[model samples]
Target chain A: MAKEKKVHDRVNWHKEFRLAPGYIILSLWVLFTFVLLGWVVGASFSTSKEIFSGAVFKFETGIHLENYAKAWNTSNVSVFFMNSLVYASISCVLLIVICAPAAYVLSRFTFLGNKLIQNGFVAAMGVPATMIVLPLFGLVAGWNILNVSLANRAVLIFLYVGINVPYTTIFLLTFFSNLSRSFEEAAAIDGCPPMKTFWKIMLPMAQPGIITVTIFNFINVWNEYFMSLIFANSDKVKSVAIGLYGMINSMRYTGDYAGMFAAVVIVFLPTFILYVFLSEKIIAGVTGGGVKG
Target chain B: MFDGAALLHLIGIGKGVTRLKKNKTMIVVFVTPAVVMFSIIFLYPIIRTVLMSFFKIEGVTDAMSKWEFSGLANYIKLFSTELFRISMWNIFRIWFFGGIIVMGLALLFAAILTSGIRFKNAFRAIIYMPNVVSAVALATMWLQYVFSPKFGLFKSIGKALHWEWLEKFQWLDPSHLFIALLVAYCFGMVGYHMLIFASGIERIGTEYYEAATLDGANRIQQFRYITLPLLKGVTKTNITMWSISSAGFFLWSQLFSMVVSNTQTITPVVYMYQNIFGAGNSMTERNAGIGAAVGVLLSICVVLIFIVCDKIFKDNDIEF
Candidate 1:
């Protein structure tokens, strides 16, 4: 806040004039983005006939909420949306549970192979999902779990959690390192076990980092497409991304462009909304941890 | 020995020993689950993919007993296939062409934002907005609306400006599809990289700029000499991320090309899918081995870029 106030001094017209080109470029680019997303939102509320006639802005009759209703109900967007919510929520909880202790250990302990484990996680961040998808698919298909619905969702969630484990651990490890070790020392002096000290005291202290990473994990799992496309073959277990792809392809046949845009809006809304609220934190996370890879 | 042991116990070594043992136990318990998950999810699959790339396996889920040892035959065959070659070329073009555009625009935006621009946060947020949205949906917006020949944003703007060429151009035509895909992709990507560059710039203290200004250095000169050089770490980061994402460029390409794989949009991962999981395999034998080889090739590309970047951007512990 202090720094911002310092930067808000009276503007020089000459300086502003000198930056005219830069301002124009950025404004035009941002204007184009608005037009692009604005047009989609407009089309989603307008009828397909009006959309075809470039009257989405005019809205000849009125705003039609049926497009969203049809997309949410008739198109199985509900199933996909619920499945994604479940998958993302469960996967995020599992990531924190599975990664927090591991990251704590990695940060606090001078154990054998600690550096190797950290390096492995970092490198795995760079390992493309394509490189590892085939054998995982083979193993899952061999187990024949994707054929069953409950087991299918379990498989999807497990994959989501597992693929994110490395990142979650690395990100949390950085958080743990920044914390002062004096908390554990005092706890130990007061008869608290090291593990208990971590759970009781240190974990809550690391909430900011945890929340940031969880937001990232949530967005990642929500937008995850390729693996879901490959593994969740049935509509019963499909994520929003894969489900939306199927709907869009079918909408090509149906020619309900408004409904298609509505589905697109529905599919992207959760993450988009999360982003709207937490853009600062999300941006911080991008530059914070596990991003070096 | 008995006397020494008794003396050590009296000195509290026994209690300390137990504490150390307890700590070890805690360490094992805490670290094992993550290691297990990582090994199952990443290690085993990576090893199997590498080994599978060497064998002639008809099915992706084929048993080990059915795998035929084929040396480098799969690699050779992958290079020989025309579609595979085109896919490789397409990805190369994406990485190369898209890299130039994204990095350039990202740097430009980063510079602009840090240059005391108004509404900086809003511009950054809006630019990065598309990235958080699902790629499938983002690509659909471009394909269905932005590239729509009739009432697309580009056509509307063109018509409003009375520009016949822009109004009539088939932006989604085969000849222009690749460029369209690249443009849409770079738009989403620039925001992330720009934030990275902006953060790097912010980390450099204002002291340096002040010092440079006092020494009669102008904004452009100071930026060229100081800002770019100080951003080596962030540039390495940006490049590594861009390459990694490009290597796994499947979702957007898949959305753009759909089921019918085209030369303009097919990437190695898409080709890998076509070889393994694609439907209607009437003529070509289902060689999951080739798919494995493509996976291995992309992994290699990622690692190579990483090593090259590390060498180029050797860290010297610069302090603000």
Candidate 2:
């Protein structure tokens, strides 16, 4: 019995030792992330000279709160911020409005060309944005629609909605199909129209899936850069991502590294705050799509 | 009585026909917007891109009528170019080597988090936060804050450790630039893949682990005999995802390079962009055909990998 106990102790020790590396790596990564972000936050509040001198952590020079003000007002981060907010929110809502109905019909109803549409979406997921971007740009330019700022914004939103339809529809398809048909049957028995049934009972049943996909769309649209860079090139309509890129490029001439960091923080804040609050939803949205696919 | 009943049945059949017509109309109403938008924006562009790859267009903005039919010339030009070859090699390294590092770390972290570790949620959240931030911001933070030779984190650490050479490491230099970008990109990506792996690991029933423990298996043994085997599907998913994302690597390479055509950090997408936009000196004559060809080649690469993964991971017997 004593020998068995000694062997058990040895096994426990071995297990702990085996897990030590995992713990170490995790802790190191956590520490590095915090330190890096903390440093950025700190530098954003410091003077450029102080930041360059590596005195960011030292509070000898009081925090320069004007970096954010300069970044927001003079550098036009506010415009970009509002632009991003508008684009992200509108695109997300429209994506759901357009995609949910399609997904619902595709999953719940047996219609002509249903399999073909399903296969189309699945095939679209494999095509990269680069493949479509050149032609799309040419088409828009050829149409001369981008000259109007509103039209440009509309095109961007439309592209966002269109590009995301496959993923959103595919993500919600499984959710709609998995729901029991009894509710719909009852609704039909109660003399409810098919449209009304979808709007009232079925949509409510798929609320969780809708919310998850919306969160995913929000994050994706919020961070979208390449398309925005191509389509929304004007100062009046730049998203936060492109605005930040512009700020970084201009910083070379201006040499306001602190202001640049401030702009970076301003751009990163919303997504960071979103992650803090709705991480579970975000994780569910991302991993849900991945695992299902 | 039989004639009256037959008339009533005929009326009932007519009503059913009207209802079916309404249902079909509703389906069209429901699906029309997505289908129309998808065809115009997604499908049309893909078809146009494939068609454009066969023509010699001076610029992306050029009129479609101006395209000169040049079959397979763009592909030959792409293959003949040294920089294009280098870009291809860079992406391959990123897809395979970067993939190995990322998947390994993600699996390890996933296993640890699911092992009843403390602060699992907090650790997961912190690691994944980088992904929430835009790649532009993250790359800037890395280029300026962490990799700067003067006031960088590396410099500070190097000074603290009394290592003079380490403090002056030129991470952004051409010699080391690719590796630097790879490391930074991997840092931001680990959490995303880790979360995917964690979800996969969490789906496994505790009974497997309990049974293995009952048989006196160690943690490593349980991982080897059960977790790894069950994670084949997840691994295949991660590889395919990594391939797709790597093929589309643009922003990081753009951010890392000082010039538009910097060979060290160029990827296929960046090459395509340069050609389409007529950005670089060597690429002054804009050729949408070459750009489209680059895109077609990259798509083929992704599709081929996906097919290979599908074949290799065809086993569905381990349903759990």
Question: Which residue pairs show backbone clashes in model 2?
Answer: none
Task: Put down candidate 1 lDDT per residue, A1-293, tens digits, no spaces.
Answer: 88766566434666688788789989999999888888899999999999999899998799999999999999999999999999999999999999999999898777689999999998899898888999999999999767889999999999999999998999999999888666665576689988898899999999999999999899999999888989996998899999999998898789999999999989878998999899988887877664543
lDDT scores of the candidates, listed in order: 0.88, 0.86
lDDT of 2 by residue, A250-282 (tens): 888889999999999998889899889998878
State the DockQ of every prediction: 0.53, 0.44
**Positional deviation of residue A276's Cα in model 1 after best superposition, in angstroms:** 1.2
* Best candidate according to TM-score: 1
lDDT of 2 by residue, B90-136 (tens): 99988888998999889989999888666888999988888888888
Clashes of 2: 0
- Candidate 2 residue B182 C-alpha distance from true site, Å: 0.2
For DockQ, the strongest prediction is: 1
Query: What are the per-model C-alpha RMSD values against the true structure?
Result: 5.5, 5.9
What ranges in model 1 sit over 4 Å off?
A1-11, B1-21, B259-261, B281-283, B316-320
After superposition, candidate 2 runs with Cα above 4 Å error: A1-19, B1-22, B62-64, B163-165, B259-261, B317-320
